[model samples]
Target: MTSDDAAQPCPMPNAHRRLMDCHAQWHRLHEVYFDPHEFRLTMNSLVQNLRNVTWLLQKQKAQLVGFDEWYLRFQQSSGSNEIMRWIVKSRNRITKEADLELLSELQVVWHQDWLQRTIGTSSKYPPRMSIREITNDVMRRYRPPFGTMTVRRRWVDKALPAWELLDATSEAYTRLEELLAEGHSAAAVPMCDLEAHDRECVTSSLRASGTRPHCMVDAKDDLEAHFDLVEGVEIESTSLVIERDEELIAKSVERYGSRAEIPTSGPIDAVPGFMANARQLMETDGEHGTFVFLYRGDALIKMGGLLFYNQNSKILAFEKLASQVKAMNADGVLVIAESWFARPTKKEEELGTVFFPARDRLDRMEALTVYAATRDGKTAGQISLVTRDASGRAICAEPDDMDDAVVNTLAPILRIWAEMDSSTN
Candidate 1:
């Protein structure tokens, strides 16, 4: 028995042993075939071996504890299941003159999903390794054996999956390095922030330098060496705020709207292709007095900013919004200012309105919560409450025992925006 076979103890040793042997014969079939006829022969043999293994498992179904989980090993994988199914269907129909166009399709799907190079513990095998030992070995060697003429074809096929893995792995390390350098604890850095920084740094670097490192081994080495630097750092949380009071909006309009070209400012609004993406941004309502407009733009594309619903009169309110949208049109997005619904403290008056840092915006989408109704020229608590996202999608709404007309006005607008589904709201 191999080291792996010895490690996993199976109750039915005879059945398990047969499965392992079947897996070995199937894997050896991956050897390169010099002739198309030889390739078809290998594929036929593999299909028959798979059929025998499947039949054996069905026969011993009661003996296995992880039959469902073990089967998932094949189903969860990208194209392995499809390849198996295709081969099974071609079994009786396959001839020595068989055209193996399906092999080309398999190459494309496998490369796209990076199913070839096994990495990480999670990617290694199923939890009950004994149950999957046979199938895993067979799948690893499913392809035809590489010959001198086929070597170049194999290299071209594997290049893309390798490059994609290298790029993603490198960017993850780069983000960790940036977060640690900024004196932020790894635990405190939200997942959204890590993803954002990874995309930004990789994109900027790629633009400046046409080439990137393709060595994952070196990348893994560097990550291990610096892992200690970020192990137990102190956590800190801070934010910069841009107040949405009257004076600031007037200045923003004059500054951004005056120029014929739009001014791109703030991380959210300065993303590439903002104009094209803005057309997709959705408007939504939120809890308390909060209103929002979520940019439906690509995650890589940035276009986020704040507008305020401070105007008391309905006519003036919409006019102010229209003006703000025109001024911020360069970024192509204008979310309602988060602070508009937040009660101001004495410290805020001194900060004024300009660019300021804040906690990751996406992370705090559901932070604000307040409920009030207008009565006797004063604001009072109301039982009914609602919350919505920038896309005008209602996140939550709780009806009171008795609904008041004044408070119910805060309900979400269900209008269908252009190019968006009418049922979305």
Candidate 2:
């Protein structure tokens, strides 16, 4: 060898880097599971990153003896594994064809005891009530037990396993990690446990244990049916309405204070200012109301109102309103409304005995949702149930779709506003 060649350092293979990159993409997939647009982007990225592991390994085959033989065996094993095969096919489809098809199922289950309590034990009622009747009866109640309502959302594809999308992805990740480890071993390279890295990175509390064989990634709890209660509620059958007027808006601004100065620290710092404004609007409105506020920095530009007969209409209305708001070149748009929210059964502290999981009772309630977006396409928001008593005193429900830190910052303020007399304000 030439003296110059002897002095030069040998280049290291980047297969390990590619493997870690693939793992990072997997974690991103978990974060964007609910957002279809973001999910697609992350899913495609994960596939590409995973596929790059082998490509990188092959690229550095000259440095690793017996790489060709080891890779051939790995390919055979991957072909036999269903998830691995799907991963390969997904990468090919994403590269050459269209995006992979995804199917989603939203299941809402009500416990048996909860239904009994809601309907009452009166024999005067029929064995079954029409969807409209049930909706009307539930809405008639001054305070519905919304916290007892359980909602489970799952995404799947015909090409994928029966498991939820996250679970399936976790299984795929496990196989890939094994392949990477074995490849490294065959190449005589030192490697840390990828599973350990995954545990440290994606520490979602929703993650279930022993759901998948040799799976280190987080997996959502499986949707299970209780023998004591009915299986699922048709989300389509539910109808809800939200109405707002100038009078309510005026009252809200007067009562909740026209301007709220949000702190520039903690989780609130990460959220857009307009979202806090929207939330303040909800807190002031206090009841079933929908509001649209356009803002430029801390200043309110224009305010509008919205009316929705159902959830679907509400969503469409927001979309149209967002488009209109964007066309007006506003700095930010805040949409705040109180509507029925259904999700997986969880304890609601405010409701007390109304949401008794030990007795297998569940309830549904109205939720105040605040959403904000900027002209630059940034968005942030929060969801919570703020109920009031006969005396107009606010009772803040457990926080939803937001961390405790954000809720704790806002809840005390809501209570304070609720105590103040509107006439004085």
What is each predicted model's overall lDDT from 0 to 1?
Answer: 0.28, 0.49
Which residue window of length 10 is worst by lDDT in model 1? Answer: 147-156
Per-residue C-alpha lDDT of model 1 across residues 189-227, encoded as one tens digit per residue: 111121112222221111111112222222222111000
RMSD for all candidates, in order, please: 25.1, 19.7
lDDT per residue as tens, model 2, 344-398: 4444544543343221324556666665544334556677676778978655554
Top candidate, metric lDDT: 2
TM-score per candidate, chains pooled: 0.22, 0.37
Model 2 / residue 320 / CA error / Å: 42
Quote the positional error of residue 46 for candidate 1 in Å: 1.2
Residue runs of model 2 more than 4 Å from their true location after superposition: 1-13, 107-151, 192-199, 202-425
The candidate that wins on TM-score is 2
- What lDDT score goes with residue 26 in model 1? 29
Return model 2's CA RMSD, one decimal.
Answer: 19.7
